[model samples]
Target chain A: MDIVCDKRAGGTLLQVNGRMDAVYAPAFEKECLLVIDGGEIKVVVDLTGLEYISSAGLRSILVSAKKAKVKGCSIQFCGVSGMVEEVFKISGLFTLFSIVPTVEEAFAA
Target chain B: MMKPQGIAFRLASLTLLVSTIILAIIVGYNYSVSRKIIVALAEDRGTLLAKSTAKKISTAFMTVQKVIDSVAFSLEDDRLTEKRVNELGQRVLINNPEIFGSAIAFEPFSFQHDNQYYAPYHYRLDGGPIVFARLGSDDYQYFYMDWYQLPRELERPIWTEPYFDKGGGYELMTTYTVPFYRNRDGQKVLQGVVTADISISWVQKLISSLSSREAEYVFLLSRYGTFIAHPNANLVMNETVFTAAESLEYPQLREVGRRMVAGETGVVELNDLPMTGDSFLYFSPLPDQHWSVGFVCSKKEMLAEVSRLNREVATLGGLGFVALALLITFLAKRITHPLRELTVSANDMASGNLEARLPEATTKDEVGELTHSFQAMRESIKNYIENLTETTAAKERIESELRIAHDIQMGILPKLFPAFPEHREFDIYASIEPAKEVGGDLYDFFFVDENNFCFLVGDVSGKGVPAAFFMAVTKTLLKVVAESRLEPGEILAKVNDDLAEDNKSCMFVTLFLAIIDIRTGVVRYASAGHNPPLLLPKNKDAEWIPPLNELVAGIMEGTQYTTKSMTMHPGDTLFIYTDGVTEAMDKMNNLYSEDQLMVVTNQCLGKSAEQLVDSVDKSLKKFTGGAEQSDDITMLAMQYLGKGSKQEGDDRWI
Candidate 1:
């Protein structure tokens, strides 16, 4: 998983590609916290390149989202496709997070 | 050849040949017996039918000829007159079984033998010989030059060409004439001609039926080759003579005719007649005539015997060939079973399954020898792997022990940050990760007095237990001097004196010791030939403070070390580290240089002492990126956050 922050939108864009499973979740969480603790809020996580997200990956995202909320930030997701999109929909996180179809839409919002 | 496939092929060949020969014998014997029985049965029926037909025809011919002879004797030798001759001809025609009619012809009477002379036989209107000696004036002139007189001049028995009788419209009649002669005087006097005006329809029907029914043909030829008995008698009498030798298509039949004309009778092949693949030819001479009869049948009928034999032999041969194949395959498998086992074992060995052993064999063959070699190989491999595993375990144990030793050596150093927690004037941090099980690098920091904080970082020569022990001792003795009343330079000098006195191993430590006055941020540091610690000036680039002496620890005891003072302004940072810190490796094996450390210190130049340390640690990690550290690394940092910004609760940053 790769994360790039755009300060203009006050959002961190996480462009994850390939499998985000149990082994990669911790490192992903640590990196997410690094950006969160930097005091940026209104985070938009771009999942356009993310091919898969398992339960562990989802849990890590929720934890990071909670941590961002504690720091007075909101994490919006965008460009969810493939199994990752289905997972988000099934978990009802599609309704929970501000999910948009593209990164541009999320950034605009 | 000794090759097993060769033996198999040879055995198969031998078995096939033997079975074929046996099959041939059985089939030939059966066919010969069957063919003999069939041929004998056919020949018996054919011969019986042919001979019986010939006898019946001959008996009828003789009886008819005898009746005609009796009529001729009555007309010529009995001196019968024309009326008597006519009556006798009528009686012959009526009494004979086969003669259709009999008649006589003689010269007109010239008053022979006192007016009692013989006359020719006469026939009535119905074509019977009428044996009358005279003709009535109105009886159709029976004695007026008979037609048989003309044919009588011919030397041979003349069969007059058939002529139609007007009285019997479309009825064909022909006369067979014979001359009557008197004996005893040898006179050439012709008494009269005896003739028979026989109806030829019976002979015509017989010949027509004979040739017209099937492929069989019969035609009579005179001695001069004239056709006599024929289906169309008039055609034979009118047309050219029938000759079998006139054809090119029947050269063999011509040979048969030649032989018949030469009086030789037997059989010969008829190369013509559109004979099939093979055919049988039979020829026989008719008795008392130059004519011969030829018969031909397809030879397929004759060779059916051989064809049946061949078919049976082929079937039996196929069965025998199948048996031979099975036997060869079975025998080959039996011969190669042991070799196949050996091959399997060999393959197993090649695939690294060395535990696979050939099965025990009692046969004293090359395969058994191979089994022995395989067993040996298996045993050797097992022993070698066992030894390898033991060696690997031992090496692991040694490695873990070395790791423990390394930790214990680190435990000997001052590793904690803020060594004097209550001293706010000086913020101190140090860290170490050894390069190996143990090394001689050491760093120490403690408060020497209420106003002075003391710390030393050093690297010893060589490594492992000897260097680590010397590090421990030197660290202890440095503390002893610092606890006494010595400055940083004097403490290192005293420790050097004590360390060099017993330095038999000739090892040394490059050290930089410092004392900081907490109330003023003035740090007085001394170095013994080590990399200078970093100092960041207020609003300036960080620089390394030059060491004051050339002596390393554990060298000559009298070596003098000098001291340099750096007065830290408020909000200025100071960083110090051993050479291991600057010399630490990154992923590419590039050193984390002093310039990089200087940048680290200056980047946090205005931050508190703790932030300076944190920045350096972060930079080190970013530069390392999972590269194995190569030396014992230690760094000490301090900063003056200044008195005005030092809030009561946040004074921890000072």
Candidate 2:
């Protein structure tokens, strides 16, 4: 898995790609906490290039969201589709965090 | 055994070789230069001796000639008598001891008118009394002798060649003869001859005394090259220099003899002379006698001191070379001692003794640095091995514990087959297989009442020990809620609320819970974000129950669940499973997807619940083709027989 972080007008953009399973899930969580800890009040995680996500991946995202909430940092997810969208709906992560269809929509929200 | 040719040996040998060559050059040069100097000095000494001896002989001859000239002047009177001539000759001999004899003879009948033989000689015999003899008889014809005849013809005073005078002196001698003349009527007439003879014994003594060394000898050669005085007494007057050169077959000696006879004075090397191996000859002519004196010096005797000096120098140089070689070897060994010790220590280390003692680094050099590095390397390797051993032990302990946890989790599931055999109304079988030592997947079945049998299959989010614990908690809460005889939806709602309370980790389980009434063939089930179960009727294709879009349990609090009812005919089976079946992957990462799961389940339509679960598992294994199972797999199947269906031995169903 790979994560590319970029500074945008709306927030810090974290573009996540590759399989987010048990092995690589910790990397995504660490990336999210790194942006939040760096005083980023708004962060957007783009999963447009994500191929697969396991339950462990959902757990890491939930853990990162909770840490971001405590720091008063908002983390938004964009490009939730395919197997990742199905997992998000079943795990009730859709009701817990803000999600959008694209990176621009995530930034606007 | 031969020792190793190490640096010390090589260094010492090189030093010895170089110094030996330099010593040889120095000694050889010294020997050659000194030999040259000695030869030159010997030549000068020989020339000086020859010249001085010749000068002394000339002075002695001049004194004897003066005495003889005085006797002849006295005999030149016109009124002289024979008795007066005898007295005059005797007087001259007595006055000069160097003159051995004196003679006065009248020219045949010139001294008297009738006297044909008239000569008188006076000589001393071996420094004895002077004896007078008349030498005018037939036995001793003094007028015909060279001394008398040569003066009459030449009319001048002259010295004869050295000879053994048998008739007069009877000894080896040479004579100086002078002719006297008388004036008669203003014309000069030859009166007689007057002569003085000198023995050559004194000349031999003088030549012998000129030599300063034992190997040096002096010789006197006459005008005809005869040996007048020589080191060998027999060769004197018997052998000339030319005869000795011929007998020895020495051309160079013959050339020296020729030069001396020609009155030339010089020094030459007498290499061809017999007995005298190498020598130098210096020859010079006497000023008065036309004779040459030669001084011979042996070259070996002259340079004996130089040879001794060279021997001593070579001995001392050899001793010094040995000492230098020893010192070099000692110093070289001292320098390499540390390296030898290092080799031993390195060998010990290579043989697996990490704690081998290293040589102390006394000097701050490369060897010292190498020793320090080796020590550091040993310590690092030791620490690395210690850390690896400790980590392996800890990991083994955790793995053993995980195995135990897996056993406990498996014990909680309903594994026994033929459940509720006395009722004969339904058959249930469930199995849970964890992907790891302990997993989050679980299945349970139990009688909630006499008529109501409740069963559930759940998948906790994430895996391993944490999920396993969450699954256990969900199963316990689910059992408690289901025993209250509430609907399946109510039991799910109550269990979800309990699990969601203070759930800080956001952990949840996807569950499909159901309650079946055995007599009525009525089933009421609810799913909390779980995969819908498949309904398989006997001799009919399998179909999936419609799923509710409800969130998985244990995520949000107070989430309501709705129960859906399905009536099962006799010989109908209901199958439930976690996503481990559908999401299983092959080596190519292709999923054993839901479509494949449906196809395999449809094929196993008439199989018992236990057989159905086994067939699905086999199909999954076949589809994955040895790829690692990424999650826990839990499967539960139930078949309802209905109220009227009774067991007829082994042929009740199927």
Candidate 2 C-alpha lDDT tens digits along B1-654: 113576666777788889999999999998999888877777777788778777777778888888888878988887777778888888887788888888888777888789887888899977689998877877777777887787789878888889788876898988888898888889989888888888888667656665567337888899899999987888899998899888878878889999999998899987746557788888899856779988787777778888998899899998998898878878878767777788798899889887889899887888788878878888997898799889999999999999898888888776667767787788788877889999998888899999888888999988999998998999889888899999988988999999989988878888999899988989999988888788998789898888676878887788988899989988899999998888888999888877888899888877788889999999999988888889888889998877756754136555
Where model 1 places Cα greater than 4 Å from the true spot, the runs are A1-109, B1-358, B361-366, B437-440, B461-474, B484-487, B490-508, B547-560, B585-589, B640-654
lDDT of 1 by residue, B180-223 (tens): 65443765555566666656565545444443221244444433
Which candidate comes out best when scored by DockQ? Answer: 2
DockQ each candidate and list the results: 0.01, 0.53
State residue B506's C-alpha deviation in candidate 1, in Å: 6.3
lDDT over C-alpha atoms for residue B341 of model 2: 81
Where does candidate 2 stray beyond 4 Å? Answer: A34-42, A67-75, A92-97, B1-393, B418-429, B518-521, B532-546, B567-574, B585-590, B595-629, B637-654
What TM-scores result for chain A when each predicted structure is judged separately against the true chain A? 0.88, 0.96
Cα shift from native, residue B317, model 2 (Å)? 7.3
Task: Please list, in the order the candidates appear, how each scores on TM-score for chain B only.
Answer: 0.56, 0.58
**TM-score of each prediction:** 0.50, 0.59
